[model samples]
Target: MKQSTALTIATGVAAAAIGGLFFYARATRPPVINPDVPEPAKPVELARYLGKWFELARHENRFEKGLDGVTAEYALEDERIRITNSGCQSGPKGERSSASGRAIVVDEGTNAKLKVSFFGPFYVGDYWVLDHGDDYDWSIVGEPSGRYLWVLSREAKPAAAAVEALLQRVEALGYDRWALRITRQG
Candidate 1:
């Protein structure tokens, strides 16, 4: 090819690369800290964190389909949050499945966020406490990417008003409410 033709092709490639980088940077950037995560005045006592927590709502995703009555049971095991999640399905009993994971607090003092590993070899995700009630009656949880969310409570179901309020809070954080799924409790 001629030198001018080669220069034009190289320029095109560089422009495309720069544009791609700009778009990705705009899309995936994390939220700037408005304020450091508040320290729990009295840390969440892990003993009460145990027991069945029904999935009152979640950010919509394809993986959890037909999994409405799901519950995540948390217990302290070896100083880690041992989690067992099980729920009904639209398939055979043999097809119904459960996942076990562990959560370890990333910061020792606040106990506000944790890293949970579900895959072997240990892939972890941020477990941010987006919102919580003083009585531990209801809580909103999400990850950094806004890819996962869960509305949890000790009761089998939460009031419609509570759900609406939680949705508003998440939306205020710039997450999408239209994509939220209200999971049916057992």
Candidate 2:
């Protein structure tokens, strides 16, 4: 009886130690954005692309955690594109949060890729247009590193059919649909 009890206690302790290590490893590991990134689908017309856009979905990013009703507005300022990203923290009427940034065309011929800077010239990130609707109703934005992605629509609350179509396109582009968090529109 004594030997059996000792064995049971040892097994329990070993299991707990292993579980703790597993959780710690998970917490420290870097997030995997996407592995198999593809090429840009087509060129983007800057003029038509400049306007208010509603975020339909995005990867679970640390900066925008717990945010919903997100929106991004763009305007042309000289040679740069102005960016304004806003979102709600809680309910529909939650306090509003916003950040301003600027973007410059990386390629003049295509105008499909941009470098966005939120903190002056020192900070920048890739903003590549993976694909878009022919009529510019929706757009899929990603980076070369595949660490981030965003789906934007011209309408605040687009039709369900259109959203589904965009999601399918996103998946086809080697993005994981489960990693996308649908945003609530106001």
Candidate 3:
């Protein structure tokens, strides 16, 4: 009986030690942002960039939780860009929810960096196009802070190779690729 009790206690201690190590490793993981990296893409053409883009994958955020079939439509209005983002709450066939916003180019030379405001001027956020296809068929968007990310395409389902290439590009830009969640579109 004594030997059995000692073995049980030893097992419990070992389990606790393993659990603690796991937690520590997770907590000590490296951050996503790498300040040494350069700025986002340059010379984005506003004309070709306007239109609807389907969200293929993104880093989780509160505003888009439980949403699918997500898409963003951009329209050029004078010097600013008008934005309309929409998604389904349950799934691809679920109820639709949409929001309208505006984006102003911060750098006229590159037309890559922009400040977007969905809730008026007081709550603006960064909207930087980090990478995009030559034909404007796909784009990877993120912010200066590196907390948000989105992979969007002109089609509902782009080629797998295109998606994989985008993921690689995103990782090279210092974002956590593992945290990306694929979105369902229909």
Candidate 4:
């Protein structure tokens, strides 16, 4: 009886240790932001190509520091999505940064999901459309797991009411309301 009790306790401890490790791995792993395939965002109904968009909010990351008023331009390059992001920093000289990347759609027609690669080797991340306005003035963008978020608008600054409506739609997608970082634009 003593030996059996000892063995059970040891097993329980081992299991607990394994569970802890698993949880830690999940919490510490770098964020992955891509769909399974290259899917194009739908509602091409919205004339996305050649539209100017301002980043209203985004998830915090190392790459963007003191960045604000960033604008992105999307265009088609031989059937692929080309992206150019530019923003300015606060300083005497007003420092600026720009990055260019390419994206591809995993789903065609109306699905509105994509995989974007910012690095030369093309590491990809999901670019899902959570919501879009009828006039295509604003949109809420997110990933499958809700880890990354972005709210974009055709104007440099979206209206307050529009932003609130967009947030409501984003909440329906299963993400914590507090997890979002609202971006400031000039």
Candidate 5:
């Protein structure tokens, strides 16, 4: 009811919001680019690329922190691609959480570079397909900043040899060996 009390409360809320933003920004893209991320893969068949993909490993981030059994599903929605990313929180048996977004090809020629927005027009994220299997069995994705990396496979539990090969390719691209956090598929 007092003016001074209201002022103090407002100030506290503002400070909390600012601090939250600071941490969120930090958890976002890496502060400095280390390994130079390459361009997107060419001749990506958008149609074939559609379907369910299990997340094998990734560069940990706040958004996906505490998540397990991660998976991304893609489907054609008119001219845009609908993306649904789902995972269990805390642990493999924990509650599930999902985020849906839409993606558009930034480079129509290659169909590898995509800008996806989960919060409508508020926020957008870039992801490029660095490489993939000939039959689209596995894929390596990253952004230009080299801060984020995602290794996905067509199967929930892919063969060890297949995953090792992909990991090798990822390391050859300059990504740090310890940066990847292998997901616990449920």
Candidate 6:
């Protein structure tokens, strides 16, 4: 009887220790810092913005790791935007993987901020258009949390000058330009 009681106490102590560690980790985790960066002055025209956009550069994330020839296609469906993202796993000619999601414009006036959901209505993520070209040839997508950033273009391969300029613009917005991984397109 005494041995069983001691075992029970040990188990309780172990559980409490684990609970304490989890609480400590949660409390000490760094929060996302969003700077006072300006959104696009003009609203995005859904019609002009539709179609395919090739990934030029992006802040490294696990979702698209080991991906190449990444492209995101947008299509208008009623009042929502359908998002189709595809990429090659190994290289430009590697195995292809795709994910589909839907986005709703958060503000009708600007059409710059959107809430996208891939897993039904429960899980949603932010999709903000920070900047874009007048002709919709290029765009910069980011979140208000400043955790993710992507540089996209209409062309599969954009010119060096254009990419340099885009990187400069991203840097000006207080993002870590060095964290951007130039996507491989073939």
State the lDDT at 26 in candidate 1. Answer: 66
After best superposition, candidate 4 residue 158: deviation in angstroms? 2.6
Candidate number that wins on TM-score, 2 or 6: 2
lDDT by residue for model 1 (56-100), tens: 877655457667677888889998989898776852232446899
Which clashing pairs does model 1 show? none
- Give the count of colliding residue pairs in each prediction: 0, 0, 0, 12, 0, 0
TM-score-superior candidate, 1 or 5:
5
After superposition, the stretches of candidate 3 with alpha carbons farther than 4 Å from their true spots are: 1-37
Q: How much lDDT does each candidate structure score?
A: 0.72, 0.88, 0.87, 0.70, 0.87, 0.86
Top candidate on TM-score is 5
lDDT tens digits, residue span 157-181, model 6: 8889999998998887777778788
Count of backbone collisions within predicted model 3: 0
What TM-score fits each model? 0.69, 0.82, 0.79, 0.70, 0.85, 0.81
lDDT, residue 180, candidate 3 = 83
Question: For candidate 3, lDDT tens digit of each residue in 1-186?
Answer: 999999999999999999998898556543445444448755799899999999999987778887899999999997789999999988999999999999999988989989999999878988988888999999989876566789999999888888888889888877777888899998
Q: Rank the candidates by TM-score, best first.
A: 5, 2, 6, 3, 4, 1
Better of 2 and 4 by lDDT: 2
Q: What's the TM for model 3? A: 0.79
C-alpha lDDT (0 to 100) for residue 163 of candidate 2: 89
Task: In model 3, state the lDDT of residue 155.
Answer: 93
Q: State the local distance difference test value for candidate 3.
A: 0.87
lDDT of 5 by residue, 124-165 (tens): 999799898899999999888888889999998888898888
Query: Candidate 1 deviates by what RMSD?
Result: 7.0
